[model samples]
Target: MKGVLVLENGSRFSGELIGCVRKGYGEVVFHTGMTGYQEILTDPSYAEQIVVMTYPLIGNYGINGDDFEAKRPWLTGFVTGETCDFPSHFRQEQTLDQYLSEQGIVGLTGVNTRSLVKMIREEGSLKGYILPANLLADGEKFDFPALPRDLVRRVSTKQTYQHSVQGESHVVLVDFGAKENIAGALTRLGCRVTVVPADTEFEQIARLQPDGIMLSNGPGDPADCADLLPLIKRLATAYPLFGICLGHQLLAMSFGATTEKMRFGHRGSNHPVQDLRSGKVWITSQNHSYSVRREGFPAELVVTHKHVNDDSIEGVAHSVLPAFSVQFHPEACPGPQDAEALFHRFLALMNERKGSQLVTTI
Candidate 1:
């Protein structure tokens, strides 16, 4: 069926419908990665959003069984310049079109994605709808739904789950629409991972006897989770903590820092981030619409890393507390894995803390 993307600002773009033939609506944003369509699609952070792929040709390698970051795709719609129907990869299990159609996901193809991305860059991400061209051309008045404030609640797990690695150290992960690889990465580092709901209380966490706490990446404005900040501050004080993406923003917010939405957020695989302490730069995978503000940066925290492109705060560490965070994903699924070593960094911090406790007891 023919379809058109109707933006709230009266912008309309037409394309061919590929998947489930129903209208799709949500915040429309673009990603600049050349691959990792599967990871991008399944990431819970993309919940209630319509993703536009900037790369001209996507799904060339096909979808594999191992690459999904979540059990299901959370983005409301998928938009691309062209989607491959016949992908060529040894591990390929299904084509992108077949998977999208099977999953009841609505996708628009043969779109002028470059033009669409250019508009988004200038005007910022917008809430929009993908409907049949006829329905749009026929002058039907449709009320687009406002972006929901409870995106994190919708995507977060209702129950705590364990991904046991049988390692000596235990890390409790506070899920805020977390990606699967966040747990996978931790387990691979020889850490037993326990995942809890976003609303899990600190007392509940204290019972888990975690050596460290990991604040997973999530969606929506960090400020919307004002209630979580108190718990986050409490967690940081008691445990060696690490935060990623949304977690990074919340960690800063918990320490008197502020956050603001980017005009066009970072949503790609090759973002360059510089480590200020080491003068090292790493190509990172990032997907978020908000960042910690430099204006009211908390005195208790020190800037550790920054984005090379925009000078946005990328990493921070608390001076007194053994807590740190990074705005880019260290557990990149279909992207770079260099930052995966950050998990070991967290483990070392946990070990150091454990040694200190043993000494105190002695």
Candidate 2:
């Protein structure tokens, strides 16, 4: 079946519909990852956007249940240059088209995805729609549902949840729409995890007596979550705090720092980031359109990492607090292992803090 993707800026692309033959609307963005389409599609962070994969061929390895970061697909649509019809990986369970179509998610194949990516890079993420002409007319602009401004709220867990409480080290994950693999990463590092909603009360965590608190990656403008700043500020004072992606932005906000939207959001598996403390560079997986502004950061909060390409603030740690946050994902689901060591770093911090607390108590 044929489908038409109409952008708010009036650009249209026609392609073969491979996924659901349903109409959908969302903010259109692009990712440059060579692999991991399944993980990307299922990541809760991409909740309100249509993803365009810049890679020429997708789904070569096929889809499997194991790689999904969330329980289901969250995106408005998917546009790809090419989508594999027959997959070859041993773990492959189904083709990309079959999986998406079953989920009722729209997907467009054989699109000039490179051109779409270029447009997003130049014009930033924009609202768009995907639909069949029977349900919607081609090139006709409908009152496309607004791309959610409160993306974090839409994706965040409604109630506090827990997993793997059997481990020795107790960690409370403040789920600002955290990806599931992040919890898996922490469990692998010996953390007994208690996952909570984004605006969870600090007293609730105090009752649990956790050893560390993790601020998780999420979506939308950080300013919308202003109510969460007080909770983050209170929790960071009592325990080691580690943050990723949108969690990083909120941490900065909690510490009198500011965040701003980027011209074009970073949404790929291979972004280069530099560790300011070690002078080392690592390829990172990133998916955020906002970043912490160095100029607005408080003097006590020091920048710990920077983007190699644009020198944007990639990570920050407080000078006097056992708190830190990174703009890139360390729990790479569909990306390289170059940044995965950060999980060990968090584990080390937890160990060191526990040892110090024991000594003080003794």
Candidate 3:
């Protein structure tokens, strides 16, 4: 079967269908990670988007059940320069094509993925459609799926859930399509985590009496999630608060800060960021198309980290509050660990707060 990718700009590319033979449409984006295709595919951050892998070959190790970041692959479509037909790895359970098809994901191979990536790099992200070239070549207009405005709602869990461990501090996690590592990292740090839905009410969350709260990374436009800002504002003052990625954006907004979309956005593992306070540079992993607008930040909040590439804000801290956030992934599952200590930083803040509260009670 033939696969054709039609960009919103009307550019088209032809390739061979390798996974589920079905039409799909989404905002086309590319990832530069040479590894972690499975993690990227299942990452809810990719929800409602079509992903083009920049690496020439994919699925050399096949797919395993243990590495999924989301419930399933949320990407609307997949494209690759070449795909491995046979994979050899001890953990391999299924081939990439088999895995994607089983999950009802559409994939295209034998396409110039490098060229596609370059196009996205130059033009920024855009909506596109994928279908059989035979169906597209004759000038038939394929109806593109309505670009989703509520991507976060579609990806977020409807009900609250929990991940518990025997620990001193109880952390209430506001799940805005959180990555698994966020909870896993907390568990490793001697914290009991209760994962809640994105729209969890403040009164209900307060009843948990958690020592801290975490705003999680998620997909889509931050402005689309206006419903969460009030809840975040209410929770921030109730406990020690920390956020990451979309969580970071929401935190900024809760303090009356603004956000803006990037030209191409950061979506790779090799991004360089500098801790403004420590003057230390760290290679980090990042994956968000929008950023908190520096101009919109309140004076009460201080910029703590910045992207060395474009001089964009990477981290922020409140002047008189035990609240902070970073726009990068510190719990990177398939990327660099330079930012892993950030999880420790959040844990330390919680520990400090617990001590202060104990002292006050006495």
Candidate 4:
């Protein structure tokens, strides 16, 4: 069926509706990854947004069960230049259109995604809608509601769960719409992981007797998560901590640092980041619309890594506390694994803290 993507600025583009035939509305953003559509679709960090794939051809490999980053797709809509109808991958379970339809996700194809991306870049991100072609001809004004402030709550887990039971170190992961690969990466590092809801209290996490804590990636602005700052501050003091994406922004905020929305946020698999301490560079996967402001950062925090493209603050570490965070995904499921060493760094921090406490007792 014919479809039209209408931007809040009154711009419209015609396309083919490949998924559900329902109208969808949200903030429009673009991703540059050439692959990983399945992982991107299910990532909770895309919640309440309409994603535009800039790579042109999408879903050539088809959708497989193993590639899902979350239980379901959280984005309000999907946009692509073209989609593969007959996928030939050995692991393929279903076509992208079939998968999106089953999951109630609306998708648009045959649209000039490059032009859409350019518009978002030139004007900053905009609110947009995906509707049938008939709606455009009606010439009626559309008033889309503002994106929700509680997107994290809408995507976060409601209960605590355990994984990697036999691993040595006990780590409590505060699940703010976390991707499964984050837990998988922790388990691979020999950490026994316990995932708790985003609003899980400090007392509950403390009771877990964790060796370390992880603040997970999620949707929405970090300022919207002001309530979590106090809990994060307390946890940072009590345990070794690591954070990713939105978690990184929130952690910085807890230290009295500020965060601001980007003109066009980084959302791709191949961003280059340089480690300040070692002067080493690594390709990373990133997906966030806000970043921690480098100016007036807390004295206790030190910048560790920076984005090579825009010189944005990509990673930070506490000078005294065994806590650190990165604005990119080190547990990249559909991207390069160069940043995976960050997980090992977290484990080393936990070990160092344990040895220090043992020596203090002696």
Tens-digit per-residue lDDT, 1-362, candidate 2: 88878888878888888888888788898988988889899888888788899999998998987988878878989999888898999999999989998898999888888888888888988888887755554345476565567777778788877878778789998887888888999998788999888777888889988988999888778888998898898888889889999888998899899988898889998899999988998888999988998786799899999999999999999899889989999988444585777777777778889999999999
Q: Tens digit of lDDT per residue, candidate 4, span 1-362?
A: 99989999988878999888899899999999998889899999999899999998898999888978899999989999999999889999999999989999899999998888899999999999998898777986899777889788889999998967868788999999999999999998889999999999999888888999999999998898999899998999999999999889888889899999999899998899999989998988889999999789899999999999899999998989888999999999445576888898899989888899889999
Model 4's number of clashes is: 0
Better of 2 and 4 by lDDT: 4
Position 64, candidate 2: lDDT: 89
lDDT of each: 0.91, 0.86, 0.86, 0.91
Give the TM-scores of the predictions, in the order they appear. 0.97, 0.95, 0.96, 0.97
- Candidate 1 lDDT (Cα, whole model)? 0.91
315 in model 3: Cα distance from truth in Å?
0.9
Candidate 3 residue pairs in clash (backbone atoms < 3 Å): none
C-alpha root-mean-square deviation, each candidate = 1.3, 1.7, 1.4, 1.2
Error at 232, model 3, angstroms: 0.7
Worst 10 residues of 3 by lDDT: 333-342
lDDT of 3 by residue, 121-210 (tens): 899998887787777658787556567786777777788777876788899888888888788888888889998888888999998889
**Alpha carbon lDDT at 217, candidate 4:** 99
For model 1, name the residue pairs that clash: none
